[model samples]
Target chain A: MPVPDDRKQQPKTTADAKIPGAYEGETVTRRRFMTASAHTAGGIATAAFTLPALGMAFGPVFEKEQVRWEAVGPTEDFPDDTYIPRTITLSPGIGEVGKSTVYVRRYNDTIDSEVKDEYNDYVAITSRCMHLGCPVRYVEASERFICPCHGGVYDREGKVSGGPPVRPLDRFYTRVRDGIVEVGPRYSLNSELRRFSPRDPGQAIDGVGQYLYPSRPSIRKLPGT
Target chain B: MAKLPTTSGTRPRGTRAETTEAPATAPQRNKLQETGVSTIDWLDERTSLSAGARWMMFRKIPKGTNWFYTLGSATMFAFLSQAVTGVFLAMYYDPSATRAYESVRFLTNEVFLGEFVRGMHKWGSTVMVILIFLHMARTFFFGAYKYPRELNWVIGVVLLILTLAMSFTGYLLPFDQRSYWATTVGVAINGTGPLVGPYLSDFLRAGPEFGATTLARFYAIHMLLLPGIIAAMIGAHLYLVARLGTTAPPWIRAESSPELREDSK
Candidate 1:
């Protein structure tokens, strides 16, 4: 829509009111010059204070996920299809070595044909329960991981089978190189994997699962699927 | 400097009567009092600070303004205590999933007065919550949220929400088992909201799951964003409180209705 002639003339009217004797081509007045200078100074001042502070505050956020491959043990040491609890040292980007336990299970053959990594045969699930971070212990008789804090149970595939947990147990990225099993960073299970099969890479949570088990704000992408 | 005033009574030495009358030998007008008055006068002349001070300190609150009015001040005091202790804690806190728990442990076990400061920050938050609740309750019971003061009430509610957010975000900084799981649940709860729920949770946690980014985000919110918001809201709240004046208790207003009618007449 075209602007009305009167509305278009508003700036001219205000300029005339401010400087009655001056025309458009006249030299800038002291008041206008000072006003422009003041605005520039204000912008500079604001940027000077804000930019560095913002950088300092949000610097860590842009940092790439700091991951180092820590060897869990030899692949031959783990029997096929059995959960072995092992402690892994995680650095997590900060200059601190943190120890956490992961339940490592080695499959005899290729778990997925799509991803051709030899390490895909292993699954390293964090011991931290999905419900409340309590250490979940594997119950051999029940064939499940049971949380002591809230009775949350995860099946052998780390899918939540019963009680309280909104999602499956968190899993770490695993790799096997030259006969040794090593784990990288830990990642939460996507919603598709809540009832995941041992063979599936697990779908990323979308649609109803997005509503059911919302994905946590993660530094890294979903590892497996 | 001359000797300070010996008497600690409410009677200030520069009373209008004493300044004007000046009885034969007024004990040299206490040189210390003279200096204090002159200093205040100088400031008053330059900046009119006395008017601002009077505006702030000499408001005529309703006769029914009792000890309940102190709740707001108590909440402000608690917030200040938290800020001071939080600053000290921030000096040693590492807002990373890897170092957060360890740093807290070090503060508690190693740093001088670190445990005490942490305890103060924790308890101060509890006290702030309690005081803000009591203050809100008192405001509601007195019908202080009516008409002219409605905006102030709304700002108070916002402040209350921000205070809770501060507490919740601060809860995860310890990065313990309890904090981690509780935060997980909290983020999941955020995801339960309609439309933006998942996005909001992801935004808050900084990605798809709680980790280093989540810790950094919470730390920034708890330490900087929330505090800055609360402070601005508090300024607005106080300005509104001063502009509108506090409400008298309903009973007192009812009892004084006759006097108010007569004065109007």
Candidate 2:
């Protein structure tokens, strides 16, 4: 017998390879076409619901936070030397869970050396611990805010004084409108009291922390402050 | 299954013929039994699903199988219990921060059998976690995670993590002081990651601080999202387990047939 053809020859098209019901120069088969169409339809159907559901859950992260100024009290209620604890509503719809305690006092020029900005006439400190978000209590005797979960301590100036606090206690932008001191949205501070956009507790904004844990888009400080 | 190895006339299971191994002559059947058998037969004829049922159910096990093997089934039943109780709990549960605690209080104190069901869901979570760990330990100590079984181990690890996520999200549903504070610390712990930590916390709470939507977000994740993924993963895991028969305990030595031994020699 003559030697069988051992040389390789690539099939130019499905028709050349003699696939069932093939036409001249055709490169596709009906079965393959049906399978691809089915798979593509399945993928599209899955993504149709999946993408919107994901967006629904994750929409809050990209949405800008609301700004509100709730009056704490008249200017005389907060003394320059000591903090007066005041409850403010952060999230309004919830009854009690939305309320958070803030220690507000008049900005003491002698101790508070940070450049006197328009927003700093009244100093308001959030009781949320820097270690975690647990509410800290102001100790009148010690002049420090203390966290109960972990022993986090903050000084009179809202700086981390001891324990596992990563930074100072978060603060709210204070402004006097109509002779009443109103606390605005929250802003986080580093150890040096340098203001940054609001961050959750346990995020340090000093050194590389500022870069590692960048400010979120939702909650930010007032534009000029 | 190639066959069920029975002398019964090839009528499907749950019939008198299967038990007695009756000859092809067959036996008289009650009308109820007739309806049931015919209904199953109709489905089997259309789908040929009986073969798959037998293939999954009639798997062979090694000679020294023991009670430790039951942990996987136990864990699966625990998950079923959790799913049922959690569904009922959601009926009375309000996911809003304002009403969440009140809803839970009503569920625990007022609704009939609500406390019992809630207790089952709350305690059953711990039970499921324990059973999963035990199953994982059995797999690990027996060296069953070798070679072809590695993919199963990977799936098991994913399931374990998902169960933990369920616990974390579920812990915050009560909206009590304890649950709220615990979730705060937990989210804070999540925020300790180097680069993505801050964003992770935000995504979990739906914003920087635990805001208005946080409770609702946790509820959705706990009931809807994680459970769906978990159920899908469990299906895949069981399919793999059925496809690949389980390994014998490490203490049980392999024993070949005398003929095979002689041939090898």
Candidate 3:
């Protein structure tokens, strides 16, 4: 057979040659081609299966002010003790908007001290931390409020003791009249009131630096009217 | 009798002489031509591989490429999925801490299939996390991250970190006890960063507590801010991957087929 002259000058590489067998270069059998086609089909099916559940969930994600609060029970249900946290829904004030079921726990006194019978001593704190907003749990044994995010620690009175907390645990202004307890939005107190303190001095609205021991029913009022 | 050559002028002189002496006599050639035409007609009746090939290249691709290699594609798919799903969720989700938790309930229970789609988006994020990690691992084990490919590896690492951050930030959007207090702990931990710890904590939560503003802040960050940055990064990552073709294993060399091997000079 006369080889083409262009073949001599071309670089000799094994891959350039055609596959062997008299029939190999001719027709591919129906079976082998079918098998390859099946493989390709299988690959594509997998991709289709994983498109991610997208279109079905887009409507709810964009509406603003969509949450509403549904009250579960009453404040009296929250006993004087360190009550178990309750899942409460908050309303976002736009459209049909609403918040999630946030758990709020109520307590009569700091965990370390004994529970008090006084009515105004009640404090309700949001379980969320002040930083990165992670949930903060009361470590009753340690008398410290610990945040799960980055380990911010607060003393029993909710003052920042350690970790990254720039401020103390948030305090909910609450009211209990005629044996009915009600909670309101959180408000930042004066700087001195936000520190780690052992004695809240019962109801001293403004004593610069007087330590009232826990359960001290009758601490002197803050100096002045 | 010598048969006439059809379209003979273009045939190579040597090949032509060989064909004349071979078994391709006139009747045999006519018989072969008839077979070719009939075969094409017969193939039209069945699900031929030709049709399948076209589907494989396009339609079936979305379904078939579920392997770990397709994870990069899945991640892209998931992002779009989440964006779409998030739009639905945003309709019912409240950004204020006071209402955030309540709104989630309405979406989860009241809205039709709201829970399911939301749940899928929730779970999809988790799956994407797993897939991205595996893709990165595959790249690493194959040494696909070497030299020219190092930039891809770096982008991949950034993407992984962003995935984790997305999960972390999203954890708080629910405005539940878990979200609020859990984030509080996270913020406090960040507060441990020495001099500016408090500042950082304040910066993260927008205040000393997880309240109305904090929820709004987190919601904005989780929805608006992070997604944009991640999408941009993904675009860059894909561009780089496409520019650098799939890196074959360092050791394997492509060799000729058996037929070519026999003919090697």
Best by the DockQ measure: 2
What TM-score does candidate 3 reach?
0.45
Off by over 4 Å in 2: A1-38, B1-43, B262-265
Off by over 4 Å in 1: A1-19, A24-41, A44-68, A93-98, A108-119, A132-134, A184-206, A211-225, B1-29, B84-118, B172-228, B253-265
User: Quick one: best lDDT, which candidate?
Assistant: 2
For candidate 1, give the lDDT of residue A104: 85
Residue A120 deviation, candidate 2, in Å?
Answer: 1.1
Q: Each candidate's TM vs. the true structure? A: 0.72, 0.87, 0.45
For candidate 3, give the lDDT of residue B119.
98
Kindly indicate the candidate among 2 and 3 with the higher TM-score. 2
- How many backbone collisions does model 2 have? 0
lDDT of 1 by residue, A1-225 (tens): 987677444344434657766656546766787999999999999999999987765454344545578898998777656689998765444432246688887754433222324444677888877664567898878879998877888887777789877667777677888988988766655445432211111222435654444333334543554
Q: Which candidate leads in TM-score? A: 2
By DockQ rank, best first, the candidates go 2, 1, 3
Write the residue-wise lDDT of candidate 2 on A1-225 in tens digits. Answer: 999998998788888888888887887788888999999999999999999988977787787878999999999898899999899998787778878899999989887855578887998899888887888998989988899988998888888889999998888888999899999988888887888988778888999998888877777788877
Error of 2 at A30 (Å): 5.6
lDDT of 3 by residue, B1-265 (tens): 1122432467753342344332445877776775675465355434455554444343312222225566678778877887788878888897765567779988999999998988988998888888787788777776778989888888888888888877778888876666655565566566555444544554565433333466676777778878898889988887676656566554556566687777537
What's the distance in Å from true for residue B97, model 3? 2.2
